[model samples]
Target: MRVTVNGESLELSESTTLLDYLIRRNLNPAVLVVEYNGKILHRDHWSQIQIGDGDTLEILSFVGGG
Candidate 1:
């Protein structure tokens, strides 16, 4: 399966849950906001949402600064 993340194309072996993907990439879901196919996804649904072929995801991580 293929998906695009932050405008970059990637190949995935199979459909995966959003949380799984984030964890695999060493991302902390608590500090990030995700947009799926143009819609903002709530953090509560990350574990339940499935990412499949051709899906587009825009992940924005929150950074703390002075």
Candidate 2:
């Protein structure tokens, strides 16, 4: 399956939940917000949402520096 992550195209061997994808990329769910297919998904739904082929995902990670 193919999906776009932050404007980069990637091919995944199998379907996976949003949480799994984040984990695979070494991302911390606690510090990031995800926009799936144009909709901002709540953190509570990340573990249950399945990523499908041709889907678009935008992952924005928070940075704190002051």
Candidate 3:
């Protein structure tokens, strides 16, 4: 299946959880926020949320600055 991630296109497996995808990309859930298909998805639901075809995701990671 194909999905749009952070404005880019990617081909993923037929079935995979959101958490798995994040891990594959080395994204830390604790310091990042995922906008799944236009809605802000909670971290608690990442494991259960299935990433379907054409799904849009905006992964925003936080940075510490002083």
Candidate 4:
């Protein structure tokens, strides 16, 4: 399936979960928020949400500064 991440095109094989994708890309869910298809998805649901073709995701990471 094909999806867009932060405006970049990405191709993923069958049965890929949101959580799996994040981990694969070395993204830490603990410090980031995901906007799935224009809606903010709860972190608890990341593991269960299956990514579909043409899905758009905005991965925003939180940075700590003094």
What is the RMSD, in Å, between candidate 2 and the native fold over all Cα? 0.5
For candidate 1, the 10 contiguous residues with the lowest summed lDDT are 41-50
Candidate 4 TM-score versus the reference: 0.93
What pairs collide in candidate 3?
Answer: none
Off by over 4 Å in 4: none
* Candidate 2 structure lDDT: 0.98
lDDT of 3 by residue, 1-66 (tens): 999999999988677999999998888899999999999998999999999998999999999999
Ranking 3 against 4 by lDDT, winner: 4
Model 1 has how many clashing residue pairs? 0
TM-score of candidate 3 relative to the true fold: 0.93
Tens-digit lDDT track for model 1 on 1-66? 999999999999988999999999999988999999999999999999999899999999999999
Which residue pairs does candidate 4 place in steric collision? Answer: none
Instruction: Kindly give the number of clashing pairs for every candidate.
Output: 0, 0, 0, 0
User: TM-score for each prediction?
Assistant: 0.97, 0.97, 0.93, 0.93
Score residue 25 of candidate 3 by CA lDDT. Answer: 88
Q: What lDDT would candidate 4 get against the real structure?
A: 0.94
From the highest lDDT down, the ranking of the candidates is 2, 1, 4, 3
Give lDDT tens digits, candidate 4, residues 2-65: 9999999988888689999899999999999999999999999999999999999999999999
